[model samples]
Target: MKISEIVTILDGVLVAGKDQMDREISFGFASDLMSDVLTLETNDLVLLTGLCNIQSIRTAEMSDIPCIIFVRRKKVTPEMIELAEESEITLIECNYSMFKTVVTLAEHGIRPLF
Candidate 1:
């Protein structure tokens, strides 16, 4: 699915990387644990998490994740956004909980990373 479609599905706000809206995302990984995120081999994946820290952005950077969706209306810091921008990662904010976000993505044919 495209990042634009995911944003529409989740009623998300694109906080950064507007140019990457057309990027393809094949899998979704929902987690708050940076350790778990670091364990994955992510490519063309969108990370769905409530964690709004810079660490989350770093994890996405290390994992090569192209996009991240912050769930439950979590607030991302300016520093986090700056880091994500530097890494070329798209950041989105959604009002849904992590569970709802995952379900919505699945219904849209976006599979789990596992």
Candidate 2:
């Protein structure tokens, strides 16, 4: 699904990379553990996590995740947003909890099984 469709589905806030809104995302990975992210392998992964920090951005960069969803009303800092921007990663924030975020994406046909 396109990132724009995701934003519309989740009503997520686009904190950065507005241009990426139209980019196509093939799948998603919901994880808060960086180690878990390091182990998983996928292209165009849209990561969902409540850990809103620079580490999350770094993890996403290393894992090549195309976009990130800050779950459960977690707020992403300006520095993290800048880091994502530098890496050309799309950052999205939403009030939905982690479970809701994953379910919503799955319902929208953005499952991780790709």
Clashes of each: 0, 0
lDDT per residue (tens digit) for residues 13-44 in model 1: 99988889999999988889989988887587
The residue pairs that clash in candidate 2, if any, are none
Candidate 1: 10-residue stretch with minimal lDDT: 36-45
Give each model a TM-score.
0.96, 0.95
**Looking at candidate 1, what is the lDDT of residue 76?**
82
For candidate 1, the lDDT comes to 0.91
- Give the Å error, residue 81, model 1: 1.1
Q: lDDT per residue, candidate 2, 6-109, as tens digits?
A: 88899999998887788999788988898988887786779899988899999988988889999999998999989999998999999998999999999888
